[model samples]
Target: MKHNMFCFQCEQTAGCTGCTGRAGVCGKQANTANLQDALTGALIALARTIQGKQTVSAKISKQIIDGLFTTVTNVNFNDVTIQQRIDAIHRELPAGTADYDMKKVWDAQEDIRSLKSLILFGIRGMAAYAYHAMILGYTDAQLDAFFVKALCAVGEDTWGMDELLPIVLEVGEKNLACMALLDKANTETYGIPEPTTVPLTVEKGPFIVVTGHDLYDLKCLLEQTKDKGVAVYTHGEMLPAHGYPELKKYPHLKGNFGTAWQNQQKEFDNIPAPILFTTNCLMPPRPSYADRVFTTEVVSYPEMVHIDEARDFTPVIEKALELGGYAEDQPFTGINGGHTVTTGFGHGAILRAADQIVDAVKSGAIRHFFLVGGCDGARPGRNYYTEFVKQTPPDTVVLTLACGKYRFNDLDLGTIGGLPRLMDVGQCNDAYGAIQVAVALAKAFDCGVNELPLSMVLSWYEQKAVCILLTLLYLGIQNIRLGPTLPAFLSPNVLQFLVEHYHIAPISTPEEDLKAILGE
Candidate 1:
């Protein structure tokens, strides 16, 4: 049953099993996938060499983070760059340290593989957050230290579930700290996000579309494009950038270009502006727009103009100016057909309204609170989220985050009490905000988070969602309904363990799941 390559870290993995074929569902080729594994193996070797030592350096720590981030779903599809990263890891490691072959972990026993995959993939997700935070000069010593330990553990063949399971949860606990670090870095750098409405219109003349989750990259592009006769538009997860005080201050940061990340291939096919991918969410570009693609940081695709660490965005800006956008303002709408979406209902914004939310729950104006959020993907059955939001019965409130909110963020869900029925809580990393909001509400309501009139019906597509789910489990939150499909990597024993301990279940139809939650 062995195919060319093996990967199941994303929700859209082939056949709900591993994508053990010529190319992954995300368009990652078999060769590139192997190179990513090689890079990870090298990084693990690097970590192992320095393990239990007092002198771990920051540059080594950052390379480990970058190396792990490079292997995440949809990040780097260029085998050339991946091998370069592997070479870099090799040069950085001490003399005679051998790279750990990843095939051992991949070909291990079923439950053993599953548990180690959780720890491995969970830390892979955490690396993205740590990378973002490090770029902002907000590094956590403990988080960096755990990255080394966890990578070593992944390559440690002797470690069983008893050892691996606790590390899996530790990945979540550290990821929480990592996320909080990134959150602090973001708010301190960009200011606490405020509720702001983002338009869906692309203004005339030259402009650039910036996708991916890196706020600093977008900030750099915004600064460079200002008054240079080019405007900037946010796409996918970058939609939340408009809510930050510093980011929103730019008048040239005009509008959002398209829907979530999954639709980029269709939406960017003939767009006049050049697209800058700052991080993950890159799919294989079509020839029509391939010339317009530019990548920065760890996101790389072959033949795309890769922006270097100097951060000079001249190529992207020139490409935009040359392309010359729409002749007139072109209006676009969300997946729900609405022309505007709102964001920045993050933790600070929500907790500021705690008194009102508490009183509304007390008065029965807000009947149930649903966290209908997580990564959105292109799989079939995703419309369940759309339908679920559409049928939320008006008395309930929907709190959403990540790109999945694009499913219903534009809809006029109206108001429950005085608050809007649907609230957009920024990017996927803002799950930290969602966590903080839930805990504060639980405190105000005088009960645990699981006992609050809140339920989590989440849709996941990648490792970021994995770490977040583990965080919820670590917090003892129960009964999370996850779909469009559960992770393919969860073996039967691991699934049973999660079900028995945390009560996580695969999402069924929206109506039936709603009855279960609302009935409770």
Candidate 2:
């Protein structure tokens, strides 16, 4: 079937196949999605051509990575902006080379299609982390080259489990490096995060809620709103901002406003504050609150206020003032009934007390470790996350990230050696933190991360989660339980490959999955 556009790359694709008609489930027009695919094809060709070149410049590499990343779901929802990226990639490549048709990969055999999808979606997700790392002045050669390698691999016709297996793990491996680079950038530019309790109450008066995964944007917003009588509250992934010393230092920076991204439609309705979305996980806006939603740095929604390069947040600030927020201080609680949440358990903070953690584990004070986290969405069965956390043994510790934790983050799970049973390791991007913690524990215990009694139970709702999953797989981490629903985009063969090789399983009932996770 001929498609004007191919959009099976996201979880919300039309009818569970490629969205070929006028628009995608994401509301992206056919022309815009086609432009994005063409841009991706051009990038793949450029990457393939540069694969063997030793002289590829950082500028070219950055453009390729950023271009692919910008095309991800809900990221670049504008046709004009996507075309600009296409033009930029075209300029980077030497003339006369034919661009690979990205649709060809999408239309390949189910198995080959699945493997390639992992590479493509994995990189798209990794690009977000790489982009964040670049903003903070961190880059790794392996990470950059992997982008080229993965893109080139997607264009290759050779398809075997061996050929595909390495690349699949490579996606995971490169993602780890990319995430590490981002972690370094974030921690150095900001600082190692410490445990911080964030309130859900929006202090009365004017305030802005910044969402998405960009710290730089949050920093910019915090800087611009300083002393403006406007309180800044975090939403979605931005909830972790409360953990950073630099960001939390702002007295006007109040607390978090909403829960996960999927709930924004109901949550943001009648909300009397402006929201600045700096990156992914943006849902289609409801008309009632659409005017109050603002986009910046590649996150675009049709008619919302778009904050441009000058980083001037004048309009967002104005909206906050105009909305005037609640009549007085309003108290909000998480889904699990807790009035507050805590975050900032980056690797540095966790490792700082490594000796204690090791001792606790050895003395049977801390038993199993469950990394329960990922992107949260509107899927009906997602409450598995809440149940997963609730079912964790009392002697176990849970590490979480992204907005998924809103399902259970509020629960008072008590503590292990002075550390809360639940540790919020920052945003989804902060999966790097969880990985770092795992690696450190492995080193301390003299075993691979896979053998460190750590099990990952992840729930993915978008491309960012895909990249993080690839990273975990690349690190040879095994037996991860992923749910609430497998990506509709993954072909059956590819799903089989993941299951056979990585032992990755889909989530079943919470009780059954919990027993299996505990090796019962």
Candidate 3:
């Protein structure tokens, strides 16, 4: 177990195990990973100090969130910035508190390590949601307090599975609340998303492609470049922004740029536009396009221009105008070669059609529903998602969200009754909506959600998907199918507990899985 460093927070960890060498599978160097660990330890120290306080300022809470979120996979690879955050955490800590060693958890007994990793990674994911909601002027005291409480638990030396299991499940409870706060902030600020059809063509002009999940950053960029003749295109999780009415209002907000985050290195190689990364899903830029990269908010790399709190996007705009974009409209297709893809099927849109959907279900026109979504990565076996969706019966509907949808989003699966067979359910945070719709459908059916013929076949990449899975487990929903791989952090006993209690299974082939799911 001796190594330079240890990391297994992402689905694509080296060799389906911990990345314990010079670099992680996501290109995060050992130095950066160590710094991240140090920063996380400092946050835990700060949390241990603040957990007993009656009043903690919003500023301090935000710092705790920033510290936790920076360690999430693919978020911050800038060692200097990571160190700066760690120093800030040290400055804020009271005199006697010492930084917790993260290796303690990584080196703990198997079952204890597994449960604690769930709590730590789960809150790392929750912090991203809290950060987003905070950006929109929304804050919840319970969510804020839970961050400190959970971090304190992660830092504790005496807590075993008996003490940690409740906190692990509480991460799900609080994350459910956190997602609700973010959903409110998003819907209120940007308006509820409507079904939007986004093109794959980049119009012939100066355009900037914004990736990652931060919609507020996109809003800021849209405002700053409104009359500058720069068109903005969505990439990865930002694709869901197009469904929000306030965002699509910008006339120059053009079509989508590339596919999922995994394809960026290849897809972005030759694009004649500057790309702005607002959040996660950042790959190390290639030399051909590295200079064209700009980051804002928490997403940072060494050489990229970091847009600060002032929210000015002038440098990004100038880069786009300098590139001048394509001489003619360059049409790009998704992996499936479709010329266009559509999104914006939030819970609102789906629930609005609930009566009709229920009628279709009762009448046997829609036999079942499948929710197949989560993060997408460069790892193999992802084709399982594509093939699984393709093999689903025509009588079933596929509701998807997150970047995982990009694998099959462009494929037109025709329609059941009046609704499209393939429905894009917005971004990763919109898992709240997926849960909402399921609960509503279950209520209407007079049964539990797991009894509604809905199957959750998820593909996970990082901590955000980890929290979502935790939320699903918290609700006691069973029979979820996950792939292309199970997490490396889940110990044999912990994973076995899940399989026996929740019936969670690693995905088999689409042919066999389809047969089993359909009870053929």
Candidate 2, residue 265: lDDT: 83
How many residue pairs of model 3 clash at the backbone? Answer: 0
Which window of ten consecutive residues has the lowest lDDT sum in model 1?
1-10
TM-score for all predictions? 0.98, 0.94, 0.98
Cα shift from native, residue 465, model 3 (Å): 0.3
> What's the C-alpha lDDT at position 188 in model 2?
82
TM-score of 3: 0.98
lDDT of each: 0.91, 0.83, 0.91
| Predicted candidate 1 versus true structure: per-residue lDDT over 1-520, tens digit per residue | 3249888889999889989988898999998888888898998899988888765689898899999999999999998999998998899878888889989988999899998889888988999999999999999878888999999999999978898999999988998899999999999999999999899988899999999999999999888877899999999999999999999999999888898899998999888989999999999999989999999999999998999988999988888888999999898888879999998899999999999999999999888999999998999999999999998888999999999988888999998778898999988899999999999999998899989989999999999999999998888999999999988889999999999999999999988999999994
Ranking by lDDT: 3, 1, 2
After superposition of all CA atoms, the RMSD between model 3 and the true structure is 1.4
Which candidate, 2 or 3, would have the higher lDDT against the true structure? 3
Error of 3 at 9 (Å): 0.7
| C-alpha lDDT (0 to 100) for residue 75 of candidate 1 | 94
Model 1 global lDDT (CA atoms, 0 to 1): 0.91
